[model samples]
Target: MRLNHALPPDGANGKPVGKEGDLVVRDDELGALGNMAFDLHSQLSTTGDLARQNTFDAATQLFNDGLEAGSALTVLHDAWNTKLGTLKEACAHISNHLDYSKAQHAKDEHDIQTGMKNAAGKAMTVSRIYDYIK
Candidate 1:
């Protein structure tokens, strides 16, 4: 039986291999990268906002139509009669896109949360790309 804790029999140095380089942000290049990331996220978020609005409108119509029928049973019946799979797929796509946007936003926010030196009133971390750049 072989022991799992046994060291390598030959050319093995047990020390950690290499240093992960510290990313130094050049103010100019960092600014440019930050701007690009912010713009991409903002555009994605805006698109999601529009899509969310459309969803609200459609869902409201569905709800209103369901309610307009005379009986509570009709409302209950309509609720159960959903094409929920199709709706779930649509929502999943939107949610996936929103998650992507939030990921980009979170990268900058992580910098802020780590107490990086930045601009004043930078607490709206997701929206403030300038604070995160340098």
Candidate 2:
């Protein structure tokens, strides 16, 4: 007959077989990655600013030419400029969201620790009730 002890089994040499359902997250590493992405996008915005300005300056000069006022090329240039503006806005949003995520992750990690401590305390209190009842 086999007896079932409550404690988990240990591997060879009496070391505990690795914990089950453990989620080990390296938040510091993740936050650093997010910060790097944010910094890269900020640099991209600076470079894009100069490029956009040059592009618009050329487009305006072309549009100002009397021969091209009614040309389809002007319309195409305007559409492209609109799309570029939207793309820049999207990049800014991405950077902002990543910054927010990094802050939230830190908050979440703290909350998890607090919750675990509270749960352990409550479990110990409940376990003591059996001794009082006996």
Clashes of each: 0, 0
lDDT of 2 by residue, 20-53 (tens): 4344446575566666666766765676456555
Off by over 4 Å in 2: 1-25, 69-77, 116-134
What overall lDDT goes with each candidate model?
0.50, 0.59
Model 2: worst 10 consecutive residues (lDDT sum): 1-10
**How many steric overlaps does candidate 1 have?**
0
RMSD (Å) of each candidate, 1 decimal: 15.2, 10.7
In model 2, residue pairs whose N, Cα or C atoms come closer than 3 Å (at least 3 residues apart or on different chains), thus clashing, are none
